[model samples]
Target: MLLKRLQPMMFQARRNYVELMFQVMGRALQAISDVDEPTREEVRALPEGFLFEMQVMPNGPKLIVEHTGDGKLHFHGDTAPRPVDLSIQFKHMAHAFLVLSFQEKTSVAFANDRMLVDGDVSYAVRMTRVLNRLESFILPKLVAQRAVKEYPADIHLPEKLMSSARIYLKVATQFVETVRA
Candidate 1:
């Protein structure tokens, strides 16, 4: 009886954490795309005006990033615009929590059938590359290993540290502004 009572609460907690992670990750992607040239290139590789969306199925937290005309990505928080060009939908909040928390690497989660991709799967591959790059930039090496399929190459420790600090600072500022709004 007690276990049953705790299940819903645990799921709710996971849901909330996933929601928060989506917001922070949305900002992190924004900051990284602004500063990381490789990420920009990946965005440009997608179809012009591409809207890449990540969300949980059956009404869950979401984040959208659109490839704009200027060849850059624009962050849209939890609100997807019309005609999302590509969407990655997690099967459940637990699935999102595992992947977002880095307990399951993205490819691993996908292989394990934790998500559904709507729209052009090739576009999803392109966005996955972007996600991998962003994860490598923002996460510590040890942690990043669990989050990305391949650790980033040609990353000097000192340079990566400095870049990570700047990106984190930007994400933090974005978080604060979000709270104040």
Candidate 2:
């Protein structure tokens, strides 16, 4: 089965929701470099009152990240409704967020009912771009760091299963590459 190969890596995947959000936020902030200075400054200077409410689904926790207009980041949960400029929801874990940003197949994945996004369409589009940039630039570093921290040694797997898994990876990689090209 295709998932057999992925099973090994799955164990290595540490789905720390908090860390994932911070990684995305850090990368998104860095993506400001891709935009003009005034726009960047405006985003950076967003009011201290500005907040983003992220409602994670399927029993995951909800969080609010406060932007201090001065480019500082803070998070709170007990705050009242503060007229957020954007709110987003995703059913999958944050790793899927990174995957969606990297793969154009995400739209197809969503259409195929593998993922769901809800919120303002325009804001979501902009957010997608920001996430794309962040994923492109930041995920490699995060993955490497996480690999070392979470799994620093080789894992042994049954030889037959390992061979099958390698085949699956090859096919999946080719599919992704074809879709990308």
Q: For every model shown, what is its TM-score relative to the native structure?
A: 0.93, 0.42
Residues 93-156 of candidate 2 have per-residue lDDT tens digits of 5534444344423444455565555556565554444334333333454443332223212322
* Tens digits of per-residue lDDT for model 1, 44-109: 787777888899998999998888744477779988767788889999888999999999999999
Compute the lDDT of residue 110 as modeled in candidate 1. 94
**In model 2, which runs have C-alpha deviations exceeding 4 angstroms?**
1-14, 17-50, 53-55, 61-85, 94-108, 139-181
Worst 10 residues of 2 by lDDT: 147-156
Candidate 1 residue spans exceeding 4 A from truth:
none
Return the TM-score for candidate 1, rounded to 2 decimals. 0.93
Candidate 1 clash total? 0
Clashing pairs in 1: none
* Candidate 1 Cα RMSD (Å): 1.4
lDDT of 1 at 120: 87
TM-score of 2: 0.42
